[model samples]
Target: MRLYSVIIPVYNRPDEVDELLESLTRQTYNHFEVLVVEDGSSKRCDGIVEKYTNKLRLTYFYKPNSGQGFSRNFGFEKAKGDFLVVFDSDCIIPDHYFETVEKYLDKHQLDAYGGPDRAHDSFTPTQKAISYSMTSVFTTGGIRGGKKRVGAFHPRSFNMGISKEVYQKTKGYKITRMGEDIEFSIRIIELGFKTGLIEDAYVYHKRRTSLSQFYKQLHFFGRARINISRFYPDEIKLVHMLPVVFTLGFFLMWVLPVVSPVLFFIAFTVFISFFGLIFFDAFAKEKSLQVAALSVGAAFTQLFAYGVGFLTEGWRKLVKG
Candidate 1:
């Protein structure tokens, strides 16, 4: 059995760390070691790590505040495993996660890999709605973990793993944050490292608890996409522009009423139909009207916020360039 080093980078989220560690304690494959890297958090999880010392092969390190990408690099430097895995502090690993990864690696040869994230049954309705909007085919979320992606599968840090050789050659993430994972994944692929998706090794990712928080997160993500394009201009695909189009159309809808009533009605109907599609799709998957209704808002929040961020950041890049 290969040792898998699980690296978690956290900042002022002890409660979330406690929950994530508790879930790790139940893993069916027990050959992994856990390293919790505290990125300058005043509300540290050292106490929480103490609780797990007896239960897991756990180590806790306290370091000055750097963003998550570099913090994960710190853990990777100290890992004792054939494969180094990165997980966000806000995630709960499924019991079968390691087992599934090991099984997949036995048959296939991948230098790096990533898995999808799902909302746990215990997550709040808003969280579930957010998850739907993120994973739904209606949004760009489909390309994230969906089997058929726009291009090569770029492993996300939230649930990503790489062989020791890959890390030794590439030296982990270059930037600390702002689409650091995407940037790292792109470099890994460009370096001729074999990267792929592990479908069954999924994690329960509890994203932001509220729609407002989710909006901010997505807005930041939109900006991050532009940041990635800075390093590799061709990384910006047509699919990424959908949100910007949606945002522009949203503003144009209000303007249409003054221009012509018929045009306004046509635009309004098109927008309503799109949202209606999201509502029914969410309802079919969630099987709850409340979640479905909230999903519409979540979907709108995801696209609109992302679109605004993309435009703002794109403008900044243009001016600065």
Candidate 2:
């Protein structure tokens, strides 16, 4: 059995890290080691690491806060497994996490891969609604879920894996902040490494506990999309611009009523029908009428927050040039 090295870059979320560690301890695949890289987080994880030592081959290291890309690369240098996996601190591993990855790697001759994220059953209502907004096909689900994905498959850092050799050859994660994972995957592919999607191997991503936090998170994500576009123009597909366009369209439709109510009404009705489609789809997956009822807000938040970030960064870049 090939050993897996799980590299988790953590900040100050010790409680979330503790839960992730506990979930890792419960994973059926035992031939794995966990490396907890503390990225200058004031709340340390030494005690948490000690608690899980008996159950897992866990190691802890501290580094000054450079960024997540640097932290992940720092852990990659110390990993001892053939399969190197990275997870965000705010994620829970399913018991079959590694086993599923192993199954996919053993059968498929892929160089790197990523899995999707889902909200846990115990997550808060806001989390559930936000999750629906992200994964719903009508929302970002089309992109983040890896369906009709642009170009080759890119695994997100939340549940991504690459061979140790590939990490060394392609150079481990160098991009930081929001879209680093996708940027890393682009680099991996550019260096001729094949990437695939591990459909069964997913992480329970907590994302943000509230809409306010979620907005803050995605706002940066939107900016990161533009940051990435500057480096890799081909990766910036038309789909990435949809959020910005949607945001502009939404505001324009409202403002246009002053000019002509008919035009505004036409756009409003069209958007409402599209929103209803998203709600029903999210409702089926979430099985919560409350989530279904409120998913529109979540979707709007996801798109608009991201749009603001994207547009902000685009303007910044334009000014710089």
The best candidate in terms of TM-score: 1
**Whole-model Cα lDDT per candidate?**
0.95, 0.87
Give the Cα error of residue 269 in candidate 2, in Å: 0.8
Give per-residue lDDT, candidate 1, residue 273. 98
Q: How does residue 102 of candidate 2 score in lDDT?
A: 87
Name model 2 segments beyond 4 Å from true.
Answer: none
Candidate 1 structure quality by residue, lDDT tens digits, 1-321 = 889999999999999999999999999999999999999999999999999999999999999999999999999999999999999999999999999999999999999999999989999999999999988888974688888787899999999999999999999999999999999999999999999999999999998999999999999999999999989999998889999999999999999989999999999999999999999999999999999999999999999999999999999999998
The numbered model that scores best in lDDT is 1
Candidate 1's displacement at residue 228, Å, is 1.0
As a whole number from 0 to 100, the lDDT of residue 170 in candidate 2 is 72
Structural similarity to truth (TM-score) of each candidate: 0.99, 0.97
TM-score of 1: 0.99
Q: Weakest 10 consecutive residues, lDDT, candidate 2?
A: 141-150
Query: Total clashing residue pairs per candidate?
Result: 0, 0
What are the per-residue Cα lDDT tens digits for candidate 2 across 113-148?
Answer: 889889899998788888888876676637675556
